[model samples]
Target: MSKPVLIAGPTASGKSALALALAQKTGGVVINTDSMQVYRDLHIITARPTPDEEAVVPHRLYGHVDAAVNFSAGAWVTDAAKVLADARAQGRLPIFAGGSGLYFKALTRGLSAVPPIAAEVREDVRARLERDGVEALHAELAVRDPASADRLKPRDRTRIARALEVVEATGRSLTDWHREGLPPLLPPGEFAALFIAPERDALYARIDARFDAMLAGGALDEVASLASRNLDPLLPAMKAHGVPALIRHLKGEITREAAAETGRADTRHYAKRQFTWFRHQLPEFEWVMPGDARGWVASVIPGREANPESRDSGSGPSDHPGMTWS
Candidate 1:
């Protein structure tokens, strides 16, 4: 079985650069495992590899979807499987890189066979999510499936809503389906993995600086362009880190500074969660400083270089922090 090297870490930790260097040396194909970068319209805000970066290496699944469409973890996993198959078939090494931990988990361990909820079920859950707080929804979920509730916090609206939706739709608990035994697509020993970790203070600094850089690097303009489309304010794209604040700013409801502050705070919180996820959920990955990634690559990759075509664009599907939906 062919397995790819997976590189994951908190945002702005330089994981992407390491992946590039490793891919360049290994001749691997960079496949995006990030949910945000999949949307073609989110290029700048998502920090997709720029045109110059993509030109330097071969990248797959970058900007393949329209921003208007909502994408699920299941969809991302399906797309990722295809990307892996294609890369392997072409005799190319596959490099999976992203900040989305759930995506990685879903790919490595097949998702629970709990199928998608019916539309009616989804609407019912959504109504509950709106009328009652996520805590209340989670409380209901806890009553239905105590085991699942035990594993999740009350504020984890996305999972809580999903779990409840599944129970309502199929009369089965999400946790029970998980207990039904889903095996790993590639066994643990089949691949090498790395999680880039910058020092805490430094990581926060980088997150701040990166957000500022993103604003200066046309992220605001990207938001402006998206705002012009007049899409639903509740759409996933509209809710991305800087997108909501920018929308509020554009609506004259808040000052640019206020929006920036909120955006920065949100990003920081997200980075914190990411660090926690990599530390706890992905214990098997080698945790190394971004500066040490080249060494890890040298030790594990054995001199491989992905084609230069994919690196021209500094942005790709896997370039951003892909978050789950509410």
Candidate 2:
């Protein structure tokens, strides 16, 4: 089998389409590297691969976790390890695709060996965060784990609470845990990595349009169901690109148009961050334009002759409606 493929890009940059095409051509399994797409409640809001698209090929780690779980990159690694083993045992090439920089980083570069914090400790930190606020928590963290407090922003509720939880659960600071990290799963040379880089204006346009499309595609309803659960606001699923804004709309806190605009703007900003993160944090990824991605994949992937149709102006299999491999 050919080397596994790693596809990373900003939201709505067509990374999913390229991955689906490659998986179809190589009989590979597409594993989700996106953080939001893992939550079952975020299928629409997160632009996760639809059930129909998933039916076309093997997909792992999509919509498998509940919205209540504060799923971490470390948790994803544990889950991904099993999926990777299963793919290798079945002799299927593995294609990791998504825009999550941390997940991709954890896959290629080792992650810190932080043990899971006990549920009570996590709940206590979260409760204290709600009662005492993030600044107070940051102050506490500064007293407990000075390095982590200094490293993390004062208002970064998630990281601040996490660091406090680590210190509370284990006497060691997060910095000490980072000194010992788990090895990368794929390692260097085991996978061919590509970051789909679309032109800035074009990418922003697509992100705005995709956000509108997602809203029409029952994203608001999905968010409503999730909000009804009254899950912790700090949970990753609750913080998905459009989820918070849509939840506000559902609660009549904003107009539908206002919510859409906020969601679109948030997504656009996130896309910009994704580009920066992949460029600086994961420099090894060869950046390819969306239109050129198929050709690049065709050249790197083996087993079948490079499909000329992929290089043509004609359409190819789409991972979702309005998304296609160019």
Candidate 3:
């Protein structure tokens, strides 16, 4: 059997198409590694694979989560472990793909074994964050868990609140929890990983074009539906690249054009960050330019022929009907 493949890159980098191609060749399962793509309510906005594409090959974890759930990397890791095991048991290669660097990191480098904070505790902390302001929480955390506070930026509302909640709910600092991290699901040498490096000008153009395409593809309607549900604004689904901007557009807070531009800009920025993150945090992944990615894959996997119909050389989005890159 071929080693499991981990295809990760910035959004719209065609990682999904590459994974699908590999799965077709190796009879593998395509596993989701993107955080936003997990939400059931964020199909168009998150650029999740379409029903038709998913029907072409077995996919795990895409759109399996509710928008309201505060899903985390740890939760994803847990889900992925099961999916990986099932794929192996069925004698299928495991193809992981997405732009979530943290998910990839957790999959390959282990994650802090912080137990789930109770819903009540999480809500209380979030409420306090809104009411007391992040600075106040930072001060409180400094007193209670100085190590965590010192490590976190004062303005980082999410991590600060999380650290405070962990301490409040478990009487342990996040630092202490980090010491007892869960081992990686795919440890070193067990997987062949690659980061698709796209040219900046071309990538930005694709990001811009894809944003408009998503708008034309009913992304606004999708966001409208999600916004009507009145989910917490801090929820991951609510904060998806296009969701917040489109929500503001729905509220008459911004024009649709402005919202689209904002979403495109945000996505572009996120793509840049993904490049930096994988370079620094997951250096184990071989960085290959998009045009060279297929060759890299064939070279790594050995003896697999390139799919004749898979026309995406990673210059942009895949034209393959069975693939949609997030």
lDDT of each: 0.75, 0.86, 0.87
Give the top-scoring candidate (TM-score): 2
As for candidate 2, its clashing pairs are none
TM-score of every prediction relative to native: 0.83, 0.94, 0.93
Task: Count clashes in each candidate, considering only residues at least 3 apart in sequence or on different chains.
Answer: 38, 0, 0
The alpha-carbon deviation from the true structure for residue 43 of candidate 2, after best TM-score superposition, in angstroms, is 0.6
lDDT of 2 by residue, 204-300 (tens): 8888888888888888888888989999999888899878888889889999999999999999999999989988999999998877788788788
Q: With candidate 1 superimposed using the best TM-score fit, by how many Å does residue 23's alpha carbon deviate from the native? A: 2.3
What digit string (tens of lDDT, one per residue) describes model 3 on residues 139-203? 99999999988899999987898899899999999989999999999999999999998888988
Over 4 Å off, model 2: 303-326
**Which residue runs of candidate 1 sit more than 4 Å off their true CA positions?**
1-3, 131-156, 227-236, 303-326
- Residue-pair clashes, model 1: 38
In angstroms, the error of model 1 at 52 is: 2.5
Tens-place lDDT digits, model 1, residues 1-326: 23578888887777666666556655577777777888898997877777766765678888998876656777777777788878888777788888888878886766766676667777778777888889898888889988888889879777787788888998989877877754555567878888888788987877788788888888888898998997744446777888999888988999988988888889889889988887888788889876667677666755344355534433332332321001
For model 3, the run of ten residues with the poorest summed lDDT: 308-317
Error of 3 at 283 (Å): 0.9
In candidate 1, what residue range of length 10 has the lowest lDDT sum?
317-326
Cα deviation of 59 in candidate 2 (Å)?
0.7
Please state every model's RMSD to the true fold in angstroms: 5.6, 3.3, 3.9
| Residue 93 displacement in candidate 3 (angstroms) | 0.8
Clashing residue pairs, candidate 3? Answer: none
